[model samples]
Target: MTLEDWGWSPFFAKQFRTWQSRGLIPARVIRGEKNYFRVWSENGELTVRFAGKIRHRADGRADLPVVGDWVAIESQPGRRGLIHALLERKSSFARNLPGRRKGKGRERIEQQVIAANVDLILIVCGLDRDYNLRRIERYLTLVSGSGAEALVVLNKADLCADPQYYQHEVEGIAGKSVVQLCMAKDPEQLDFLFDYLQPGKTLALLGSSGVGKSTILNGLLGEQRQKIGAVSDAVGKGRHTTTHRELFLLPLGGILMDNPGMRELHLWGEEEDLSESFTDIEELAIGCKFSDCAHKSEPGCAVRVSVENGNLSSSRLENYHKLKDELTNLHRRR
Candidate 1:
């Protein structure tokens, strides 16, 4: 098939030209397994392994080719390709390794790439009992820092008694760029999200389990490519649904990467995203008496005054400060 048929564009063509001059073939990694990958090349889908030079040059786990990565491959007649080099990533969403303690004898905070070069991140949160504004804020910070636009998708809207109330709550947090209040069971509601599915654009779905991410994928693909599990009504939670990350091309256009739900999203380094997500608080601080006011127990602090005067929720301000401290700590370590 031609490159256009596989969603290749001028951007990829230019990258491919540079690699071709260096006697390397261009391929897109379709799937990643342990120590191997399935790449889509000019010829067809070929299983591939990393070359010794590529393996030796890796800094850590982040150096490997993940789903949505464009790589340079060495091809041979009637044989699988060998990945030589990974192209520079346009964007990536990642997090620090969990259970990584701080201070002396601390384990290395490994970076796990969730997806690469994505244009949009759909932060799916179920309307049942799994919805948490704090969690959504965490995702917003991560996506904003990853250089991708974030859209909050509150799925299972049909299950809610008053969806508009919850929708307003999300709007209050997300501000602008809020996409749709969708029910994963309905196909018509899912079409609103299709506008972002233009050719060559890639999207990644991320959230906790039982948010109906797989059901949304089924609606978009018009088939059940991902397995959907039943959530327990007694507890209002789902069994760990997706166990892996996989990418699939939409029939209309664009690509979608479904990832396993993450219970914990420890911030790695996203100070800019935090500032962007909490722009109101940042703007409020500009009028403070001191430039470096802590906004807590500081004289003439506009932010603290706002919270005391009911202009801002105390809980919201608390969460913002918590995330700010996390970002500062992450920067110091880096």
Candidate 2:
């Protein structure tokens, strides 16, 4: 496949010119480990290590190459290749390191890049008991901030009698984003997903365990490429099937990045995305009498009024306020 088929575009092309002039070749990082990466270049897949300069320049984990990153590489005669530097990302999905401790008072939060340069994020949610609207909102905020379009994929539809019922609930929260329903166990049910999976496009499968992410991955590949974990009948949660993030080329010409199901997604910055994800509340805020309406006991508060009128769910508003406060605290710490 050509570079363009691997999701390379003019945005990355312009930035890669400098590296090309330096006699380094451009390669897309397919998989990344602690210190090494598997990249797809003109000569095919190559095992590459970070150059000394790159290591010295990197400030943190985000500065290094992650899956779906394009980098400049120097090939040695017989030894492993060296990655010089990473090109600027068109979009990146990141979050605060889960369960990592944070220092108080002005200490910057530790963030980890989940995937870089993703074009779309398939927020897979199961129709089973594992489904939670709040969890979907958290994933939406993360993807919306990454500059990638979010598509809510409701998998395991067979488990639920009425998939449309769940679809409507997601649409209410998703706003402008599309919500798709499918049963990963039945490949025929997943045919509709190909409409969004075009050639050269990159999509990331994101959801919690037992949400059928791995099953969906294998479905798209038309084979048992990823191992599927068995779900517990009592708890309805699946074991950690995918242990790491990986990029797979689809038979239909799209690139798919399958990530390990996150137990908790602690959001970082991207307050604007938070506003976008909750446009319903934002629309109501515009009609508020005060420019800065807290929506608590404020006079002529459209948001609270909507909540009272049954037009908006109070839980959604509570989550919005909670996330807004979290971001506000982050900004103050910064």
Candidate 3:
């Protein structure tokens, strides 16, 4: 198979030129295990090991190859794959490591790498009791900060008697971009989401457990390629179905990655991304009396005025401030 057949482009070709001179082969990592990976090359799928130097040079887990990383590999005449170097990434989605004990005694807090080189982030939220606008805002902040476009997908729409109500809620947070509302089990409602499936683009689905991420992937694939687990009928929550990050090429074009649902998503110092995700709030803040207005009890604060007048939901503004504070704290800690 040629590089084009493997989704290589001029941008990747230019980066590969230097590695080519070093007698290395170029490949894209399709899936990653603990220390090993499965890469797609001209020779087909190959199980790969990281070069010792590459592994030693890594500072933490984020330095390793992820599902969508393009890498330079050392391939012999009849060998599998050997990853030599990681090419510069186009974009990445990441979050702070959770479960750390609080206090100054903590030495280091690691950043978990979710995915790399993704073009779009599909934030899936089930329309059942699992749906939360604040959670959607959190995902939006992470995606926007990652420097990738974000689209909100309200899965399990069939269960909701008033899907339009939730659709409007998501639209208030997701500006301009299409907010998809559909049942993970219905293809008819999924047709509206096909506009994002253009060739050469890579999209990643992210959400909490029982949000039907795997179900949505199965729906898009038109078959049950991914394992679907049953959600709890008592609590209306889904069990974690996908255990690893793996990329799949859609028959309709584009690539999709299914990742395990994360229970913790601490921010990673993305102040600008937070601003972008809450564009409505940012725009209103510009008209505040002071450039440095805190928007809390500040005289003539446009943000406060909007909230008081009901132009902006008080809950949304509260969430925005909460996220901004989180970003600030994370930045300082970093």
Best-fitting candidate, scored by TM-score:
2
lDDT of 2 by residue, 1-334 (tens): 8888888889988999999998998889998787788888877788999888877898877898899999999986654589998999999998877343456444357668888999999999999998899888888888878989999999888889999999999999997899998888998788888888888899999888889998888988999989889988988898998887888989998999998888878787757878889988988899999998988889999999999999999999999988888777766664
TM-score order, best first, reads: 2, 3, 1
Which residue pairs show backbone clashes in model 3? 210-238
- Measured by TM-score, how close is model 3 to the native structure? 0.94
Better of 1 and 2 by TM-score: 2
Candidate 1 lDDT for residue 311: 87
Candidate 3 regions exceeding 4 Å error are 76-79, 101-107
Query: Model 3 residue 187 lDDT?
Result: 62
Each model's backbone clash number: 0, 0, 1
| lDDT assessment of candidate 2 | 0.87
Question: Of models 2 and 3, which has the larger lDDT?
Answer: 2
Candidate number that wins on lDDT, 1 or 3: 3
Model 1 worst lDDT run, 10 consecutive residues: 1-10
lDDT of 1 by residue, 167-272 (tens): 8877877855584688989877898887789767888889888888888888999998899888888987888788877777888887888887787898866677
Question: For model 3, how does the per-residue alpha-carbon lDDT over 1-334 read when each residue is reduced to its tens digit?
Answer: 4555446788788888999999899998888898789888887888898989887999877887888889999885554778999987788899988554567566566788798888899988888888888988888888876867888889888889999998987898887656888787876567876888867788899988888888778878988899988889997766787889998888888788998988888887568886778889889989999999878888999999998899999999898889889888877877
Whole-structure CA lDDT of model 3: 0.84
Give the alpha-carbon lDDT of every model: 0.82, 0.87, 0.84
